[model samples]
Target: MRSLAGLAALVAAASVFLYLLSTHLPPGPTRGPPGSAEEEEVEEDGGVQEYRLKFPSDLDELRELAEMLKFYNREHHGYVLLLFCSAYLYKQSFAIPGSSFLNMLAGAIFGPWEGLALACLLTTVGSTFCFLLSSAFGKQHVVQRFPEKVALLQRKVEENRSSLFFFLLFLRFFPMTPNWFLNITCPVLNIPMPIFFSSVFIGLIPYNFICVRTGSMLSEISSLDDIFSWGTLAQLLAIALMALLPGALIKRYGEAHLKVDGVDSNGPSRAEVKPVRERW
Candidate 1:
């Protein structure tokens, strides 16, 4: 009950903050002319009513918003940064979609380097918030909901305890696993906060750079599919494989050494490997 209350308070506070912050943003694009399709509706009585339809907050709306903001970004750069970071964090903490659009917008408006930096920083911070939130209020529920997955992840964590950092890097660098799953499961697996932080920060760089660069080239992109061609995925997979190599090497060599020394792979240590006494 206490945890639930805390979660509620946190959500309420975030909502209020976002509401206040949004008040400062420039007005949305002006409505189209009176006879525009968006503003025209046919009534049952055969009369044409001008009823403007509000756009939902989705990729298309986000892109339109980004386009509107581009005109004012240079003059109100600081406010724009604050707005962008706040919106990104809110969406991430709540597991909302459309961050892909935000990533691209960042590149389009801020350019590649600045956009990448912002996206990376905001992503780490937002993901960390979600991690802490789940640790505090949602871990048990998530574990109960996905017991098999949790069990599998637990075994993987135990098996790779010595190479956990590299495992995390591989997970982040490759999008084979969803990041929200990692954020929620890491706490349940008892992964150290520092390891989680470092893995998320460092591991996401390559992928985020790709997203940001794609955003910078938004003008040329006809769809999201264009951003991640086979070539791009191959490059990302190559980097992920490289990240896993060091850990694999360490584990392989350690096992070989243990085998050579007559140490039980999963049992007693070298000290226990002694000759038996002749006397019964």
Candidate 2:
């Protein structure tokens, strides 16, 4: 019952927040002239369908929103920025999907450089909120649900403590693992906040630029695949490899120095250098 009440409260709060946000925005386009093709389709589906607003999960819906915002770009710039930032933050805080659409929308509305900056800033901020929120509310649940994975991650983090920042950079750059999982696990693994923030801010630059640039060319993109061609993927792979290089070098040099000093690379050496007592 407590859980149910909490869930209800969360939903209510989100609804109120969204309602407030919507009220501040410029009105959407008026319904297509009555009895036009859009209305005809609505009538064919029954009037009930026309009144309901579905969640913006469909690409068509996102594209439509982008189109609508384009009309108000010059007139209501502040409101648009506020709305975009708020919505993006909310999405990230809850680990919601569809950020790809938002990234594209940023490019479409702000152009590439500005869009890239916005995407990175909003992502870092939102992800910070997510990290803190997960630390408070979801950490135990995640640990309970995936003990083995958590343990493995903990071990890996411990093993790479010296180069953890670079390891994090690699994770952010490549994103082979989901961001939400990383947000949750990083807190649980006790990674420092500064390191997490720095790594996320810097490591996301290349990928964010790619995503934003794709948005700048929104008109040319017919599918997501079009944005991530083989050439693009290869470039991204190269960037990820580059990000990993520093950590790899650090580890390699540290191992070499340890070997030269007659120390075990994996552990302390058994041999000890002791001062010999002088014969008096």
Candidate 3:
């Protein structure tokens, strides 16, 4: 009876966690999804219009504006914004349209924390959408249409299921991992959704903050000097360096405590410790 109760509890907890991880973001004007008229990768008019550069001068004012948005958010029981963000991302991955523009627009709607939270949530949900689509289509279908670089992603996911969370983190940090590729193959790899989403939430949080803060800073940025501020680079680099810390620590500690002593070093046995060849 106790064992059954424990099992039931575990299942319920897992279910709840899954529900949270799979949550989506709410939608707003100008944000539809992937393949939507506005979000097309290949716009018939040529390329995406250059993002306009218009930022308010005062950061305090921007901060206050973000706060006001958050205040109004109180009326929703909670997570309504997150839901819209999630849905937008998921829909975008599917070609709903206007996703690119709205990704930036996310800065205006949700401030840093909420935007970061919702972005992380939505990115995971979007990845899952890709995963499902890829699973349905298969890799052969994926490679021929997409670029050569995409195939490598499929191979990595195939070989490295155990370290996928870390790999995903690295990819999200570097901004190199193709979200669509991961989306398509993860389900195919049979990676449990919870592990995938937890990684997404933790990994992409920094990137979301960057976008949100960048949006907030847009007004102040004018000249090239303002555009490439040293302080911003330093902060971003510091965060990036933090990701490498675990690797550095592992190497540093692993080598320091070489398990040599009682077990004997790899060197030849000492004369005292070595027995003379006996004629047994």
Candidate 4:
């Protein structure tokens, strides 16, 4: 209950901060700063119009929002970046969904290369923040809420303990399991921070790249279907399969010759698995 309360309080605080930031921002596409040449150009094009600054639910809304931000980015560039980062981190830290829209938005505003870089960086940092928050405040609540899931993942982690990093990579690349669940449950699995961080940063590059690249052509995208079509899914599955190969090789090699504390060299000795279970 204390863990639940702590998580609730932190989430509420983050929500309020984002709310305040959103409300304070200028609401529409406007000219550059006063007396600037861009201001005249913007005025000649037409005065800024109101647009809702909210999470877009569809492609059309995403395009509108992206255009609005791009227009705002002209004059309040720093604020635009801060707003994007803050919102991205907020969703990530809280395990909220809908970041695909934001990734595309970054591409639309920052262009392809910059957007991909920003998306990858933010995905890593934001996910790490989520991991830390889960470790700090949500561990107990997560275990209680999803006992079976917790047990299953714990078992899988133990099974892949020798090649945990590749297993983590496989999970990220595959997307069979939702990323939020991993972020929240990893601490409970006792995965090391460095491994978790590295896996997330590296594992998500392809996913982030696709989103940002699609965002670069946001104007042409008619629907989310275009983003996650059969081809893309197949490609991701291929990458996920490749990720598993290293872990498979590692496990096979370990079983064939590995020894634990001078124990049997055939398979994972009882000695190897005992300590991990004891820790849990």
- lDDT winner among the candidates? 4
TM-score of each: 0.68, 0.67, 0.46, 0.74
**Could you give candidate 2's per-residue lDDT for residues 19-67 as a string of tens digits?**
6776655643333335555456546665422222223565667556665
Cα deviation of 82 in candidate 3 (Å)?
8.9
Model 4: residues with Cα > 4 Å off, grouped in runs: 26-51, 220-280
Which residue pairs in model 4 clash with each other? Answer: none
What lDDT is obtained when candidate 1 is compared to the true structure? 0.67
TM-score of 3: 0.46
Model 1 TM-score on a 0 to 1 scale: 0.68
**Cα lDDT tens digits for candidate 1, 157-246:** 666788787777666765445787788778888889999999988877766776776666663456769658886566557656655665
Task: Put down candidate 3 lDDT per residue, 168-255, tens digits, no spaces.
Answer: 5555544444454556545544667777777666665655565655554443354678756997677557655655564455335434
Q: Tell how far residue 93 is off in model 1, in angstroms.
A: 2.1
lDDT for every model? 0.67, 0.66, 0.48, 0.75
Q: Which stretches of candidate 2 lie over 4 Å from their true place?
A: 1-12, 27-59, 220-280
Q: Pairs clashing in candidate 1?
A: none
Q: What is the alpha-carbon lDDT of model 3 when measured against the actual structure?
A: 0.48
